[model samples]
Structure formats: C-alpha cells, structure tokens
Target: MTSWRLSRNSVSELRPVLSYPFEAAPEHGELCEVAPGVYWLRMPLPLALDHINLYLLEDEDGWWIIDSGIALGPTEEIWEQIFANQLGDKPVKAVVATHWHPDHTGMAGWLCDRWQVPFYCTQGEYLTGLVYTRATSEHFGWTNEQHQIRAGRGQVGADAARKSMGGAGHITRSLPTSYRRLEEGTRLTINGQRWRVVVGSGHSPEHACLYGESLNVLISGDQVIPRITSNISVSGIEPEGNPLREWLQSHERFLQVLPDDVLVLPAHNLPFYGLHHRLRYLIEHHEDHLLALEEACSDIAQTAVELLPVLFKRELSDSQIGLALGECIAHLNYLYHRGQLERSVDDEGRYRYLAVDDTLPMRLRKRQHQADTELPVQV
Candidate 1:
C-alpha cells in the first residue's frame, strides 16, 4: 500500500452528512472506476494538503485527463507507471485543467507535450497560470510586501514573509504556449456521455467543474469538498478582492443550478454523494466563520494577521504565512464590503478592521432570483 500521509492540521475531524459511495480511494499509480468511463487517480503532494485527486474519462478513441498533479519526480514516476500499465493502451485525447493552481496544472504542459494533445481550460485560468508560471521573485517580492503591509503586518513581518515566499518554480513546472479554451456551459461528449463545463470562482479565477447529467457525476475541482473547505484567499493579484463573498455566492449559484443526487468527484478527500447536503454545509460553514470573524472584530480593531487566530486555530509556519494572510484578508474584505465592518490604517502602517453597524449578516436569499438569468448555455 502506498503511504497517503497528511499533516495533522490538514485533517478534519468533522464529517458532514455527505455520503461516500466508494469504500476507499485509489492508491498511487492505480485507478478506481467511479462511473462507467470515469476513473479516479490520486497523486502525492509535498505539502500540508498531502495529495490531489486527478481523473481519467474514457472516450471511444482515447481518454481525457483532468487535473495533472504537481510537478514532482515521484508524481512523474507514478504517471509513467500508469501509462505503462493502465490506460488500456489508449492515447490521451486532451488534458483539461479545472483551474490554474499548481497542483492542478503543474504537470499539464508535460502531459500535453508527451501525448501531443491540446490543453483545455478556461481563458481566465489559462492566462492566470501563465502569469504565475513565468513570475519571478521580483514580481512577487514588491507586490507581496505591499500586500502584507496593508494587511497589518509591518515592514519586519513583510520582509520575513517575502523571504519565505517561494517562487512559482517550486510549484508549477511549465505550461503550453497555446491551448484550447473551456467556456461556461461548453459540452463535450465522451463515450456517448455529455459533460458540461460549470464555471465557478473565488477559490481561483474561472474554476471549471464538469457535470455529466446522464452519469449523475460532477468533477468538482476544489469547488466543493466533502470535509474541508476550499481556501478562498485574497492574493496580491487582487488585494482588495472580496473573494469570500464570491466564494459564498458561487456556492449559492451551485445550490440553485446543480442537482442534489449527483456524485461529487472532488480534487481532495474522498468522492461523496449528497451534493445538496454538502453544498448547504459549505455555505453554512463560511457563514459561521464570517459571523465569528465579525464578532472578533466588534470589540477592537484587528489586523488581518491578528484575526488569523479566529479562523485558523493551529500554529502557522513561515511557509504558510502567505496563504494564511490572504485568507485572513478575504474574511475581512467580505465583512467590510457587506457594511458590517470598517477598515483603517493603524499608526504602524497596518490595516485594522472594526465593526461599524448592527446590520444583519448578508444573506444569499436575493441571489436565487438572479440565478435563472445566468443559466448555463451551450458553448
């Protein structure tokens, strides 16, 4: 058996009402059939998250790959093994990435190069991936420092974080210079089953989830996980972005559009059922966190760094500072935009957030009315 190791902080003790149809996840370099032609593949990640689940959808002439793992020697070795033993001697038709995150698109270029196939992803994801893939330390150092300083960390903290912030070379390896675009509602028939592209946001720009109505399966890439919530962070690319709001809004959109009976194949954790149950849980989870963060900001003005304790209870390492700060800012920006909090700069050149009004927490009730106007369309 291959070791599936995750840091203690990454594991969640709370299991929601979602149902897991599969008894266990596929071991490394192995595939488990999830649907008629969809198979599950897990790859190791040298991070707190530990692993990411990729997918293979079979077609008449070839197979479609979803989400290549991070660019690591072990990951490549596992792919080589799978290519030698699995795939039934069929060629890869295309490499589809749900988003631009390194763990999802890290090996995409290499895979496409190997199979001589086109890389499929949304325009937003593709462009964003290119920016990150070619980003130098200087590109991030100045902007990231400014971002951190505005988040309430002083120069000292900013310098420390800048030094710890590794370049993109550590995560993403390469990307195809040219590629195919996956637009919203785009349908592709594979093995007589139609899969529609369901675009989502907040976690990443234009994240795509594939929903197959006939198969009753959804390939949700970090959009909806069964146990842990996806990281909705404000990055240096968009410092004042209210991604938490967008994240919640996306969940609302999903609840309105997607069916409850589909089996969700997420990028993390085990594949599960009870889509509606999990979606509602995810919305409530963030709402609860927002309320907690709101309450934390009521008494005294708090910096994003200071408010990190309210969201994450564990001790954070230096390498995790960037993500932690980004998530902290996301929560602050959500409340700030919702009129529940006010932001100001402190004497130390750091941002501080404080509650302003007794307004009710923002609700998604109004979003339902607008859902139909933006229904999925044919590509």
Candidate 2:
C-alpha cells in the first residue's frame, strides 16, 4: 500500500479539519480506547512508515482483533504484553485480516494457532495470500527482475534492483489451512453491536472494511487512511488489472453509503472524523494525478520509469522504487484503457505511453513526431 506523507498545505486546501479524537496514540503493547468497547493498538513496523494501527473490539466472551501486525519478534513480544496486561483474561475469539498484506495478515497464522481462533477474510485475499506464500524464487524473484528489465532497467540494474526488492513472499508465517470468507454486506454482531462488512479493491484484493452504525465508527483498514494515500498498484501477478479505477470507484461507493460524521479507524493513522471529505480527497487526488500525467505524455511517448518524476516530486529510495514504478504503470494503464492514451511495447519489451489527442498545434505535433523518431530504439 501507499506510504504516508504529511501534507498540511494540500490537505487544508482539500477538506476541513479532520477531528483526531485521541490526544495521543497508544504506547507499544498498550491499548487506547477510541470508542465504547473499541481499543486502538499501535504496533511498530520496520518500514519508513514506522507504525501500523490495529483494533481490538470487546466481544461478549472474548475479543475480536482486526489486522495482525507483521510476523516479527518485537510484534510478538508486544502481543505477549498485551495478552498479559491489556486484555486481562479475555481470549481472542477471532482474527480478521482486512487484506492480505504482511503488515495486516502476517501474524494471522501464529495468532490463530496461539488462540485457536478462526480466521475471517475474503476468499480472494485468502487465496492470493496462499499463492504468494507458496511462490518460489522462480515465480517472485525472477519475475521481479524481468519486470525491472521491462521497465527499461538493464540486466545489471535489474539484478541489483531485485536484491533491493526484498524477499519472495510477504507472509512471514503460513496462513490458516481454512478461512471463513467475508462477503460484501455480511453482518456480524460483536459485543452486542452490529457491524457490517464493506469490501473494496485496488489497494488489495477484496480489502474488507467494517462499518458499525450503532457505534458510529468505521474500521476503515487500508481502504481509507487519514494521512496517507493507500498504495494502489498493478503488480506483476495482475499486470493488466485496473486497480486505480477500482480504487476510485470504491471511494465513490463509500461516499454514498458511509455517513460523514462517523469516526474512521484507519490501519495506520490516528482515528479521525470526516469520512466524506477523505473519500472526496482520495478521488480528486488520483484524478489530478491522472490529468497531470496525461498532459505530460502529450509531446512524447514515455515509459513508467521515464514518467516517475512527473508523478513524484521527491527522490525515492531503492526500496521504494519498485512500488513507485508499479503505481506509475497503474496510472498509465488506467489512461490507456480509457482511450486517453495509447500504449505500446518497444522492441526492448518496455512499455511506453503516448497521448491520444491529435488536435494540438501543428508545431507541437511535429516536435512530438521528431522526438519519437530521434529516440533510440531499445532493441
């Protein structure tokens, strides 16, 4: 998913101030009550984002956990403390993964086995995670190298980039042998309150968000975050998927269905109130990026690598490059499918995008044609 970047200026212009009801996030291994019977748990992540927020709901007999932290020693230690100090004698009745990401589901298997609890998630996410964990180097590692090469990175660069891309699979532990599938609109009662499931895609396959009307809260997982735009990328596994379109459409549906005043408990950021404004901001942000990308492609065909600067204003680390590239391709593919741009693969196997509009000034058209011709043929 997308990384969090603080943009006070842009956010202020886009929407009104979002209320952060909590004065401070919970300390490690501790839980902060956000609503009645709902506790916020913050876990540390090794990544630049630094922390992931998980939720714990008090059930009649035990508790329900939403989004397991990554499978790491520190995370486990924190859980142990939570088990001993925070949860009292209550057991974890169920573990719900909002998506298949390691940060969200990495500890599912361990936690499930520890508590012997059922795993609840969508079928698509379960299967995807299963495949990802079982994937060999041939499937993930080699594929990444090839993808990098296709993006105009040479064989040497591809190999180096592959090393920086990290491990083959995201899951640190095996998933449960079986899972209870959570379909859209499914309803479950927890702690004497009814919560409905709302599913979305693009950031992850079948990402589940929980909306509790009685509690006036939404457990918005990665589907909606207060500070960061969730990463929506077309991965090598589904290169042709139009996730950007799915992401935008999901927000549209959320706007119609969700109430504006409900508190949003995101996977990463602090709990906030302003569901409608956040959805609109996410939609408009992507639309603006698409328009700018389309305009950039007007004069010449560009590969995803070539257009990175058009999308990101700052430099990216080696670890961030792969995700950036994937997101760039996703935006390009969205425009390509919508007839706003023409996509083509060069002899070297790299994909390039060109604007579709032909009504531009003759001088600009001639310059475009000349630029295209003068560009070196990769093959």
Number of clashes in model 2? 3
Write down the lDDT of every candidate, Cα atoms only: 0.82, 0.81
Model 1 worst lDDT window (10 residues): 2-11
Error of 2 at 357 (Å): 3.2
Model 2 alpha-carbon drift over 4 Å, by segment: 1-16, 141-146, 160-171, 358-379
Query: For each candidate, C-alpha RMSD in Å?
Result: 8.9, 8.4
Residue range 261-350, candidate 1, lDDT tens digits: 899999999998888878776775676566667767767888888899877888998777778888878888888888888888877778
Runs of candidate 1 with Cα error greater than 4 angstroms are 1-15, 164-166, 360-379
TM per candidate comes to 0.89, 0.88
